[model samples]
Target: GAGVSQSPSNKVTEKGKDVELRCDPISGHTALYWYRQSLGQGLEFLIYFQGNSAPDKSGLPSDRFSAERTGGSVSTLTIQRTQQEDSAVYLCASSFMPQGSGNTIYFGEGSWLTVV
Candidate 1:
């Protein structure tokens, strides 16, 4: 089975622009999550969707960031009015269930965003 994959591995954009990043999760996995890891920072959860449950969006940093999952699989994260502070690694992961505190999550290499 194919693992999760992301595109553009690297992206550079100017301030105040909008960018869209894509993620393809593994097949048959019912849970998908998006996270961000800025330089020297920890992984911060962004949004997550599992089957028919409402998405958890508590970790989205600001109104500029938003995401959606279609068909319970592929997802895309969009940042409007991008800022330099948004530069970071956007990672996508998927699993069979909501991972517990210690459960492992397989991660994509991540899309590196650089705001100039």
Candidate 2:
């Protein structure tokens, strides 16, 4: 894809259900990141993957939240036993290099997950 691509742009789920959001980074980009934004709040970092090194999952809020990057191109974020507090917009971004390297990061429109 020309830019970061995210799936299921909008989702509404019952509390306690599981949800999976997908992201496809721009071709050739080696770094991908997942972030969450609650209503009226700024983006919160969730997970980050760079090349084949260990993923930085330090941002995950709880054991219920997890993510994985496949073949270093596509990524998925899973929220298990979702709670109403989990309602938020999940944004995915990709960059040619690590943010510290001062590269441009491109973001997807984000998947809006509503737990009711």
Candidate 3:
């Protein structure tokens, strides 16, 4: 991964087109997480959210994507009408873990969404 950027982030959108994305916040006793995927692309983020109790609700937004905790383990991220740009690998992260902690944000396997 290239690492975080200092430049101001951009949140641009077009006309009536819809986009979708997914993510998994962290879930743990100490509020820690680990992102296993590489952010080779950039520091881009998610769309909306749907879930009751995400360990870290901060990472998710209630408008674009949805997430949920199941069976006391593992999380799910689902986005509807995914955009063509969303075809990139999906990354899930948790702000639960504090800085400097061994347990950092965790990324899921690439979403591999196809917008056909």
Residue lDDT tens for model 3, 1-116 = 22211111212334334443333344442232222222465644542222334444454434455655444334555544445444444544444344456645444444444444
Which portions of model 2 miss their true places by more than 4 Å?
none
Candidate 3's C-alpha runs over 4 A off are 1-40, 45-52, 55-62, 93-100, 104-108
Worst 10 residues of 1 by lDDT: 96-105
Against the hidden reference, what TM-scores do the models get?
0.91, 0.96, 0.43
> Per-residue lDDT tens digits of candidate 1, residues 19-89?
99998888877888999999999999998878634368898999999888888888889999999999999
Clashing pairs in 2: none
**For model 2, how does the per-residue alpha-carbon lDDT over 1-116 read when each residue is reduced to its tens digit?**
88899999999999999999999999999999999999999999998999645468899999999888889799989999999999999999999999999999999999999999
- Give the clash count for each candidate: 0, 0, 13
Determine the backbone clash count of candidate 2: 0
Candidate ranking (lDDT, best to worst): 2, 1, 3
On lDDT, the candidate that comes out on top is 2
**lDDT scores of the candidates, listed in order:** 0.88, 0.93, 0.40
Residue 25 local lDDT, model 3: 44
lDDT of model 1, residue 23: 86
Write out the backbone clash pairs for model 1. none
